[model samples]
Target: MAGIIGRNVNGNIAYLTALEPALPGFITNDHKFRANDGAYTEVIHTNAGLLGYVSDLGHVDFYPNGGTDMPGCDSAECDHARSYYYLGESLISGGFTGRRCATYVGAMTGNCVLWGNLNMGGLVPKTGSSGIFYLETNAAPPFSRG
Candidate 1:
C-alpha cells in the first residue's frame, strides 16, 4: 500500500471511491484492505472467480452473483477483462444498481433483502452513505440491470 505512494491510502481518504478486480494482478480476497480513517470505499466484484473477493474494505462493497462461482467462463484473461466491460457500460448507461446487505456474508451469499439501494458507478460519487451491496448482471453484454 505504501509503495504505491508515500502513505497508506487504506488509512486516510475522504470521498467516494470504486474498485474492480480485473486480474490477479489487481488483488484477491485473501488480501484485506480497509480505509480506516473515514474514507468511503466501494468494491465491485464478480463473486469468486479467478479474481476473487478483493476485500471487505471499510467502504461500499458490491457482490455480483453472490460471490458464487460464475460459469461459462474458462479463461483467466476473459475474467480479467470483464471489469472493463462493466465499467464502460456503467459510464454511459449509468445503471448497475445494488441493494444494501445486512452483513458481508449476506452480500457474499446473495441474500440481500429489501433494504435501500444505490447506483454502483456514476458521474457523481455516491456520497453520504456506505454499505455492502448486491446486484446481478448478465453474463454477457447489456450488463447493466439498472
Candidate 2:
C-alpha cells in the first residue's frame, strides 16, 4: 500500500541533520519520503510493514512562494512552501531492535530553518511461531495539524 503521513508546515523554515547509518534496515520506498517545498508534508512508502518515527533531527521550514527554491512548490506566483526532514532512531525493547533513516532536502528563499524533535515508536517487526519475523514497520506518529 501507499500513503502520506506527518504534519503540516505553516510559515516557517525547517532543517534536518542526521548521522550516517543512523538506523539499520532503514529504506526509502518512494520519492515522498520527506516533505518538499514549503507546505505540510511527510514521508511515503510503497511497502506495508516498514515503520517510521519522528527523529530528533527532523524539522520543517516555511517560506513565501517565489521566496525559496524548495522542491514542494513550483509556481513562481505561489506564496509559501513547506519543508520536512527525517532522522534515524530506534525504540525497540526486549532484545528486539529497530532503527529509522530519513531523506530529502529543500532550500527556499525567504525561508528560515525551524528546529524541532520528533520521537516515534512502534512495531517494526512481527513475531511468528517460527521465531521473530522482521518486516518494515513504516510506522509514523499520529497525524497532527501542526
Candidate 3:
C-alpha cells in the first residue's frame, strides 16, 4: 500500500516527502504519517518519538473464558444432585444478623429470600416426587429435638 519517507536527527524533527495528492494532512519530517479508513485508526509511537498509524476494523473471538460455570461446587461430588437444593449456614458472634443461606436452587430459591414465606399449595408434595428440596437453617423447628 502507501509508505512513509522521512529523516531523523538527535534534536531535530523529521519530515515526510514525495506524498501522492490523495494523501491529506501535513507531512512532518520527525513524525510518521498514515491514511485513515472509515473505522478507528491504530496509532503507535517508537522510542525515537516517531508515530505510526494503522486502520483497524476490530477483533472477534469465538471462545471467551469469563468464569461461565457456576461457583461453590468445585467438583461433581460437591453437587447435591437434586434439581432443587438449599444449604445455609450462620455464625452468631456479638448479636450480629449472622450469615444466611450459602447455596440455593429451584425457581422459588432463585426468586425469593431464605427468610421469605413459602406459599405451597395443598397439592404440593412434601417428599420426593420429581426433585428433592432441602433447607438448612441455624435454628431448629419448634418441635425439633436439640
Specify the highest-lDDT model's number.
1
- Where does the lowest 10-residue lDDT sum fall in candidate 1? 1-10
Off by over 4 Å in 1: 1-18, 21-33, 36-39, 47-50, 68-72
Alpha-carbon runs more than 4 Å astray in model 3? 1-70, 81-88, 91-109, 113-146
Q: How well is each residue in 10-39 modelled by candidate 2, as lDDT tens digits?
A: 313232211111122445434233433222
- TM-score of model number 2: 0.17
lDDT winner between 1 and 3, please give it. Answer: 1
lDDT of each: 0.60, 0.22, 0.18
Which digits, one per residue and each the tens of the lDDT, describe model 1 over residues 57-125?
Answer: 545777765644433446655554455566678788875888889886888777888569987775555
Comparing 2 and 3 by TM-score, which wins?
2
- Root-mean-square deviation of candidate 2: 18.7
- Residue-level lDDT of model 3, residues 1-146, one tens digit each, is 21232122221222111111111233333233332211111111100111111111111000001111113444323222111111111111111121112222232133323343221112221121111112222222211111
Model 2 misplaced regions, further than 4 Å: 2-104, 107-112, 120-146
